[model samples]
Target: MPPPGTFTILLFGPAQDRAGSGQVTVQARVECTCGELLRALGEQHPALAFALPAARLAVNHALVAPDHRPRPDDEIALIALVDGG
Candidate 1:
């Protein structure tokens, strides 16, 4: 199990490629907003820095705004824009 205040963020598409994995664990306060979480991810994974601005955060299968607060138990996923036809 992850330590308290740690969140396992699921990665998709370019996010997974940049992160070099399907998921990542981030440490944050229990009441952190999605915006804060995004910042943390970028700081922890420099490869994701450039792609993060265009990414959207999903909490518990639902797209949330930057101000949305996420709980420890909530499922978090980072959705980056995909390019293709």
Candidate 2:
């Protein structure tokens, strides 16, 4: 389990591959918006920076806007964008 105010992010597809793991935990005691989390993830994993911008964010099993701020226990999933028709 993550600490208080921390959200667990489950990486998928290329995001997971880039992260080299299936999940990541982020701490947000002040204000942890989905966008901020993405940025933080990029900082933690440089490879993610390229994918974070194009990655789709889902919170708690629901697709959320970029500005959405997830709370503790919220499940965050980062889905990488795939190029092709």
Residue 82 Cα positional deviation in candidate 2, in Å, after optimal superposition:
3.8
Candidate 2 total steric clashes: 0
Candidate 1 segments exceeding 4 Å error: none
TM-scores for every candidate against the unseen true structure: 0.90, 0.78
* Pairs with steric clashes in candidate 2: none
lDDT of 2: 0.75
Q: Candidate 1, TM-score vs. the true structure?
A: 0.90
Mind giving the per-residue lDDT tens digits that candidate 1 earns over 1-85?
A: 7777898899888778877899998888878899999999888888888778788789999999999999888999987886869
TM-score of 2: 0.78
The local lDDT score (0 to 100) that residue 36 gets in candidate 1 is 95
- Model 1: how far is 70 from its true place, Å? 0.5
lDDT of 2 at 27: 61
Q: Residue 85 error for model 2, in Å?
A: 8.3
Specify the highest-lDDT model's number: 1
